[model samples]
Target: MPSGGARASIDLSSATIAVTVHRQGATVPILIDGRIVMPTGVAIGPTGQLYVGLDHAAARALPADHRYVDNPTDLLGTPTHTHDAAPPDPVELLAAVLRQTTFYAAHQIGQPITELTLTIPPHWGPRRRGHLDDAAHRAGLPAPTLVTAPAALTAYATTLGLTVPPNSCVLVCQVDRHPATLTVLQLVGDHYRELATQQITTPHDLDHLIAHRVIDAATPDDDPLRTTINHPPDAPADDRHALLESVRAARHLLVEHDRAPVLLPAPRQPAVITRDDVTTATQPFLDTAAHTVKEVLDAADVDTAHLAGVIVRPAPGIPALTERLAHATGTTPGVVDHPHALADGALALTAAHQPGPRAAAARLPRVRLRITDLAGILALGACSLILLLQPVLTADITTVDSYVVGARTSVPQIGSSGAFAMLTALVIAHLAPTTWLAGTPTGSPAEPTTGSLIRRGYLAAAVSGLITATLYGLATGTALELDYRPYLTWTLGAALPLAACTALIAVTAPRIPADALPTWLALARPAIHYALLAAAGMFLMRAALSLTIPVDLTGMPGLVGSLGAALLGAATILTITDSRVLRALAVPGVAIAYALVFTYSTKSALIVAYLAALTWWAVRLTTKTLHLAFPNAGAALHRLVNRPHS
Candidate 1:
């Protein structure tokens, strides 16, 4: 490349947008004439006329009927008077600027503009890039290559021979007229990746800081200056615009010299703003910028000792900002030639990668997954574990708590809230078998027809049972004073009766076809298994608590022993039987005969009979839900058939 060879780049920022064309191989990167415009002020009227470079004041002053379309790419859903009266889009606005700049550069250099590159923020995702690409296409430019701001800055830095050592981390502090962004970039081998980034909103803060200082420097007689500086929202649009532009100019001038003269409305002397005044006014903003740099580094998990240096946009040369950045990052910051360093690096990137999907994807540093998902998963797991285990662990602890309940003595009657909750869970579990059966695959030879619903129901029931057990434990801890903590014996004792009843019913009960049931009941079969589990679990917990009518089993030990023995013998016979109706009647027959012959008291006999009847009824319902409706019922039946004498 020759010293005078053409190179062009565009920088689009929220506050300002500029196109710079410079020589490729020049020593200082000689800047030819360029076009600069306020991007925020770019608006299109209802008349389809293109308006560019209007200040914020003029934009807000459009007639009540007129709509302000600041960003062209966002006007997709905006309504127009008619198809013919459709307004210009963002692409047109962008194209017009590019066309104007290209024409200007071509006339000055006596050659047609060929290559153009664009520099954008690293955080701007795919959608924004697509918008820019469409705009460039409509602007009639060979899709200009796109580059990130940090990449462009690094490119310009390399050109200036201010490159950081390989593997070193650098923080880029981008403070423009819009919001400030602090990006941490690590140079790995020869490539750079963005480690972390943070955004800070300080646009108005800086402007207000400067404006306040300039106004304060005036004489006490300056009431007009005070009022203009205050800049009420209801003020004329043009006046507010002038005040904003005035403060901005003073800010820029303060960067170069000690003092800048600011001209305001009449009847007030021009305010002289010193660099010290600007520093004092903007101390908070500078503090925030410095803090943001440190935050970005912290977010990336990089130590300050590992930092290479902080790189800031060049023009606003404030030593206070440099000192604060050094203190925050433990490294003195370096400067680019100007904010245009972005355009320079963009030009470098354009030469390296051509415009295409592959090039664009490869050029972008791969984004890391968000940490929030992992945090959420951890929180959910912790809550579930606590819910499951809290009751079991705290059973003994409740004994101590019962003593501390301050003697609100009442009748020892059981409340129904825990029972009701368990019942609800039971109903839902009961419906699981039906749902699984309905959804089972029937047409395929590869599919097994009988066991799908049963397996699903069992699974659903087991889940619901565990859930109900957790709820029962929690509720019992709050409602009753019983400790079942050494839980293994109680668990086995509770399971024995349920198991025996299930075995007997499976051997004796008549098999019912799932489709023969009512439509509503059939649909609910899948959830019924879950309800059964919850009910069984709650019943077990009640048994473990020894909660019953205050009858003393110890007073009639002989009767209790006989009752227990009779139940065991009956369960064994029914479990081993071949006849279905006989198996079903066996337990009831044993209970009735035992109650008539062995009982000394009618209440004890009635209690025995009631327990037997309830168990048998539950067993019958469970077999229907499982054997007929459950997908895995055949396995249980097969196990029963193959069982030996034991």
Candidate 2:
């Protein structure tokens, strides 16, 4: 009922379906629904819940037990006669989409659209149309006009006031998601009639082929984006969506421009897709498109010499297609100008035909959200709020730092406000938007082996933590009081956790394959998480002791030294995974550790022991060696420090 172009149109494709409404007085058509869902994907989740459309749960690689039916059109396959078998439940899926469309029309136009003029592909015969009509009826729409896509485009052209010579032939080439189709329409006394339709199936699905090419060309084999594409994460879906959009945009730009830069995430360079790239990648598709034009003309028994005009569908990446089509048709091609040309034509036909009364309003099905989706939303909100408060938090921390350092300061023990800011900062770091992307790898077998490996990693982290605690305890003596804590505790506490995480990786390296180690390391780095834990521990310790160090110049060296030591440990574990590098680094590391032991007391012994353990783990793991005593050693240290009499 929104009526600028006289008829509303639906452009349904394999990728997504959209409805366009022409507002009164507006020259151009407006798209009402923008949700691009998979037309073929209809699935039932683990809970026996039907989840149709482009949903993550359905799109993701399903387990063996899960039920997913691709290309649900078969479910709606047309019956031969009245007593034919009933169509499958996937009819509900198509009906569900129609009800949604009806709801959209009601909301936008303030009335239900019972009489719709459907524009379909020329190849969709009576059977497909029959199924479509059935779906519309089920969705509460009455019998509507079904117009072929080419005829609709011809109608749209006629509405646009483009004159067609009587007894002449016009070829309309439509390039969409699936394949290229060329339909010959014969003009007779101002009316366009479909004469022949030909579908070119070779070099199929150009968009999909081009996207894969761009991805392969732009990204390195080791890049996480490739892994993400193959095994999609439980996402930041926007990134995944943006990646595909960039590829499509690149393809479009390549049609007109010499080269276009497509932005991909870090570690993956932006793809500079060229016109040559498009032509080369989609050559087969262009050839197919061109070949289809000849097929349609031949089928219509029309000669290329007598063809009145050729209309190419206006698509960004189809200039080459147009060129191929023109060469085949032996006529200069006119671009369709409007993407909704077919829709516009259908709208005009419906206006002229004047179908039955509008159908009554119908209720649409509800889409359910999973628990993980809710948690992700909440996490995203929390992260957003934290990010907004960062500047204020930073200012507070600076003020506290100045108060603690200045000669005229009177802030008692670096107040909770300052500590709170530090804690918040730790939280913010952990909650970074990229954290989800960098969190975990998908498609790892959900078996006991993986579970055991995770347990080992945690145990290793705990052991490394205990070793650090015991080293500090030994250095400062059995009393280990908070009063003796150095000014470097803040840095030491923060750095300790990262070191433990590094140690955790080194300890688990042998259990995991060499090829899989890097990605696992990237996701399980736990540097930020450990930093938060360390900050918490330091906060508790400082609060218990009512202690705060006056900011002094001398403390800087100790803080830097603590950070350097932690970094040294981490770098050693991560980079020296190679036994040759491990051996080369270990000698100097041990020399330094020994010197610290003699010069800096028994506390230096802990640092040496920690370094030695890390070096041993790296060396042994690289050489396919195993150490059963490592976890036990950590347990001994934990008990020795905490249970003094045991």
Candidate 3:
């Protein structure tokens, strides 16, 4: 993780991690072996995805506690991939960098990175910095930090004599698609100070038009949306050949259309655009950058009446972009330099301003952050915490039979993957412990009447019975006559099995101190809860989706059998090594149950098998739930269910 303590012996030559980069759109890795042999372009990883060469970094930066996030669930609660439409994630950059760890094996000869030098954009604020730090920590690249892109460039340049004439200014411009940054430095005797820097994203109707045109070229099967280069037409081209060629293309386009087309160079591409072409396709962007440079100089209130020459940089070789810059500044030298010039200037400034190696380090004071109310954020966090725990606390008994059916779906005929089965059971296990929490809420003091207790018991039983019956009737339809006796027999059969599980919860719950209930429930039960939540999620989702005439809750009977087998396997595994396997076993069983039922049964049979499975799962689910709830009687009842016949 990113270092947060005292300095350690860190060697730059050996303390390097391979970083893969997927910027703007290029998804690939560019390895940097601490020693800076690379000069063209350095790789920049997003946030913090880092790995040791050919090895996994031992992550040690997560907060003391962490909770499960509901993975992207399908419309019916089945977990789905978080790929498409995942918010514009910086994490991808981190991932790319971490992937580079593999290439290290191909060509190694080094020690693990102990210190990291991360490069982030200057525009990013403290919050962004904090998040980046966290990411770096997770990747095991934490230490004496380096947090600025320009700063890193300056450091590199300083090693190469990094000096310029006094009273001269070196302006740097990074011409890329989104925003173009323009920074100017003032050389005061021995140091180069940043006079002004501004980043501006072009805002013109031309890009919109071009964007529309680009999309129009795509087929219906394509991933239609695409982001073009961030700059307008005038950004300097890196090569004469590229610039001339693009100008030729633009000229050809000009001949074809009465209105000029917007010109933008793709990020990282070596294409060079001409000044006229840039002005035509993307004038506003260039104008903004140019205007900012002029304004910064104006703000300095410099005696421009007799200032030294201005060295304008249009991203190194892009003369088209720089030609205009020089023209605007009217500097005698008026030549474009490399983009790193500003960073080099900054390094010189820092070094000249503070001569010694440990200069100004102690002068910095402890800074406190000032903010407004945190109530909204705190409330949101609390609400999320509550909803996450809701399933464990309340035992509605509405679909306890379905829950058990989820258990029984483990039947082997369906060929459930062991992993899938455990997943389901774990899900249930999470909710089960919670179902029996709080000493089962004892009857009120004065109102403790046997009759009322009897009513409550009957009410629980009746509610469970009705929900099971109604769901069954709906799932099975009226045709297949269910021998109510056998149905009840199967449900009752679950009582013993469920009671056994409840017994364990009853035994464990009381042992945990009051404060630990939420802790255990939240932390230890993630796998268990998520799995069950996912399974129940699948069941309801499948059923809900089947809203029309005879919608299949799950596929077929064989699947129900498979689900039952999976559950059985999970029970065996858990018995041998009682891990969080409930949800693990059940979700797959439920999923497999649906698939099997779909494959084996006729449309009519699907309803019967699904409802039957639901009934079974519900019974087991509820019985176990209640067993965990009331310790004295619940525990006794649970033991009775699991115990051998007298």
Say which candidate scores most in TM-score. Answer: 1
Candidate 1 per-residue lDDT, tens place, 420-511, comes to: 23233334333333233234334444542222333344345444534444454444444444442323232222323444433332332222
Q: Write the per-residue lDDT of candidate 3 for residues 403-481, one digit (tens) a residue.
A: 3221112111111111222223333333432233234433335532222222233334334433433333232211122
Which residue pairs in model 2 clash with each other?
7-347, 114-359, 475-603
- TM-score computed on alpha carbons, candidate 2: 0.45
Work out the TM-score per prediction: 0.47, 0.45, 0.31
lDDT per residue for candidate 2 within 1-646, as digits (tens), equals 2111123456543234446554331223443344422344566556555545544334555665556655445455554233524323656666666666556655665444545666677777777778788877887876657777777777777666666777888888777555667889887753567889877787436655666577788776776666646555654554665676676777677666778887787656677777777777787877667666777778899898667778766557656777777778778777775556666677666554542111011111112444553454344334323322221222222235434321211111122122222223323222221223333434334412332444344445444444443343233322222232431242234334444444453444434422232333344322333223223322222222222332224444344334334433443344334366765667457435533432223323333333344334334432331222122446578778898573
Which candidate comes out best when scored by lDDT? Answer: 1
Using TM-score as the yardstick, the better of models 1 and 2 is: 1
Once all C-alphas are superposed, what RMSD does model 3 give against the true structure?
28.2
lDDT of 1 at 276: 82
Model 3 clashes, total count: 79
Whole-model lDDT, model 1:
0.51
lDDT of 3 at 132: 49
Question: Model 1 — TM-score against the truth?
Answer: 0.47
| lDDT of all predictions | 0.51, 0.50, 0.35
